[model samples]
Target: MSEGNHSSVTEFILTGFPGLHPEYYGLTSAVLFFVYFLTVVGNATVLFLFATNRSLHKPMYYIILNLSVCDILFSTTTLPKIISKYWFHSGAISFTACFIQMYFVHCLGTVNSFILFLMALDRYMAICHPLRYPNVLTNSTILILSISAWTIASALCSRLVIVAYPLPYCASNIINHCYCDHIGITMLACTDRAPYGFPAFLTAMVTLLGPLAFIIFSYICIIVAVSKTAHSQGCLKSLSTCSTQLIIISLYYLPRCFVYLASNVGITFNADVRIVVIMLYSLAPPMINPLIYCLRAKDMRESFLKQFRRITIPKKGQVSALKKS
Candidate 1:
């Protein structure tokens, strides 16, 4: 081993699911395909609805659009590799591919976290300080915040690629998860700890816990304000909105924190268990987020159904003309 310089890792073997048991490979492929398919469709629906519907042109929906983009990016960052792992019965990823996956996955994950915080704060302003909501969450401010959120997430999480690349992995090149992730890469490091560890830790805290705290605090104020509101209908509406956002935040963060933070806690000792947890962390949120929005949001529900019907129902004049022709 060289003293100061490090050799680049040529490739990484992903050991998630033991390379998909021969008997179960078909089942695994089917299941993962379905999940990835739904994730794409669901997030795409959100993007389309928000884009086409002029009524959804508010700062809140603008934020939702940003979140949808993040979700789509999040799913994209890992799902293809997951599919390849399952279908090909090969889990080997090139070092370059691994780094790219890790970078984008963390970037999207952090963006989602900050966007959720922004969402909670939006709700807080709308509910707890309605009079000041418009001025505070203006279009310009929302754009600035959204841009800042992506930039910060990308900058913060980029260190994983920077530090993890130089680590020696002569002993083992196998990553114990399907998708490239922090833990998977960290395990490849010959040293138990490295420059990667602290940077990864700091990025996780900044991207995960910091935004989580902001969301929780914002929702607390939102709930209290809702409780004090005199109008029952208004209170119900506010509660519904806050509850929906809370559920999404939970879906996004809880699994992530469990898998990432538990690395040090000894709870994620089993590699198989860790892989399962990480897969859920990757697949579940994108699946659930659009459902939550469509179910809880009346406008979204109406627009979705309206668009659905518009595509399905044939025009009466067109039908008659076709019959005549």
Candidate 2:
């Protein structure tokens, strides 16, 4: 594994969940397929409702739409290959495809963090600065913010990929994770990986923690403002909104923080246990987000019910014709 004898890796064999028992591969693949199905259906329902309903064309719904799209992209990027690996025993991935997956995985993740932060900001504006909320979060403003999130996330992730790609991956080509990622792939490099690893780690922390800090601050201000309101109903309503956002935020960040701490502080966890934790944090949010965020909204719930009825209910003429027949 000397630097002088370094050779480029062409493909990688993904050892997804090495601790998973071979006897349970079928069961695990089925469960993953079910989760992936739910993720797609839930997020797609949210996106379709937003796209087709003129009533949901507001700034808040627009942000939710963006979030739904991100969930779909994230789930698509990570889940299918793992499912294929478990079900069909197909785990070989080309070097180019691995890096491509790594790029989108981190890129979408960064985008999601910023989107959640933006959501908190939107709520803060609506509650604390109601008079200026409309002007502050106009369509144009939201568009610019969303674009900035994608652009900045892509740029930072691109740098990480660029730094990691050219390094000599002369050692083992087996990635011990479900998919390609900065840490999982970079660690396979033959030479001193400190130069690449440190920057990638730093970037990951900033991407995850920076938005998290802003989200926390935003919620604090929101809670303070809501507490100062005279009406108890308004306070309850505001608290309810903030609570949902906080739950989603906690689900997304807490497990990630735990993993980082455990890995860095020498806290040992079984390989399967660690992978399960990662999957839960990464996949659970996307699967349940539509329920937490969209279904929780009174208007959205009502609209969805109404839409469902429209699709299921028969026309008056058709009902009469059926009765006559």
Candidate 3:
């Protein structure tokens, strides 16, 4: 064992899906890679829509742009290494790299939570207090909120990494998960973890539960406001908007709360089940969020249709040129 704030283990081997059979490695890796592809493509398309389309330059889509960026970044930070691990049989990550991965993983997760909070806030203002929403949620406001989410997440998550980094690790270097995380890394320390683990757990809970409480409250208010509207079509339209956000929220938050709470309360989940739940919460929203936006948001749908026709159909000058050629 080393003397001062140093670990004897230099690197870690990521054991992705402990129960995955040897023969199924290729299948699992292929599936994950495809998912990663979808996640990137979907989020990227949303970003492109925001950049090129002037109509999406409003506050809600601004927050959505933040969400898309967060999802793409979160997926990129955590997925590639594991993909390499399964596809190329390369899971050995250095201790420093592991901690860095943990920081981004936790930090971006918190940012995603904050972005979701902003999304709900936008809805709350627009529906519950329609008159003031125009002044309240502008581009500058979204930018400030987005920047604050990133700054706060970075500041808070840095503590988790800093506190855990100095722990003495004279034990096994095998991390029993897909990627390095505070829990997976800190649990390996050769010292009593209560001093460090509890704080990390509390931080995790704060990041998840805080935004969730607000989201619930906002939606409750939204529901009440919608119910009071005399126009049935207007009520349905507002609900339709909220339904997509709720679906994305449910996908992102439910499994995560269950896992975090269950862990704290000593409810044991199967290792494979836990990992699958984690992956579902982490990966599923990013991939499907853009689809939800396009399918549900009339503006986004119309924008895409407009783009599609512009691309597939040619201008008159181009048609004349083609005929001449």
Clashes per candidate (backbone, < 3 Å): 0, 0, 0
Q: Report per-prediction Cα RMSD to one decimal.
A: 2.5, 2.4, 2.1
- Name the lDDT value of residue 199 in candidate 1: 67
Query: Model 3, range 1-325, lDDT digits (tens) per residue?
Result: 2336554688899998999988888888899899999999988988888888999999989888988999999999989999898889999999889999999999999999999999999999999999999999989999999999999999999998888887888889998888999878987889998887888889889999999999999999999999999999999999988998998899988998898778767799799989988988898898898888877877787888988788867776688899999
lDDT per residue (tens digit) for residues 1-325 in model 1: 3423334467888766863467887788889889878888998999899888987788888898898888788777787776777688667888778888988988888888888888988888887888999999998899999999999888877766777766666667777777787777777677877456766776787778998998888888877888888899988977877776776678778888877677755564666676787777667878888888887778888999999888767676679889999
Q: How far is 274's C-alpha from truth in model 1 (Å)? A: 2.3
Clashing pairs in 3: none
TM-score of each: 0.91, 0.94, 0.95
Put the candidates in TM-score order, highest first.
3, 2, 1
Q: 37 in model 2: Cα distance from truth in Å? A: 0.8
Give candidate 3 regions above 4 Å deviation. Answer: 1-4, 315-325
- On the 0 to 100 scale, the lDDT of residue 216 in model 3 is 99
Better of 2 and 3 by TM-score: 3
- Each model's lDDT comes to 0.80, 0.87, 0.90
Superposed by TM-score, candidate 1 places the C-alpha of residue 190 at a distance from the truth, in angstroms, of: 2.2
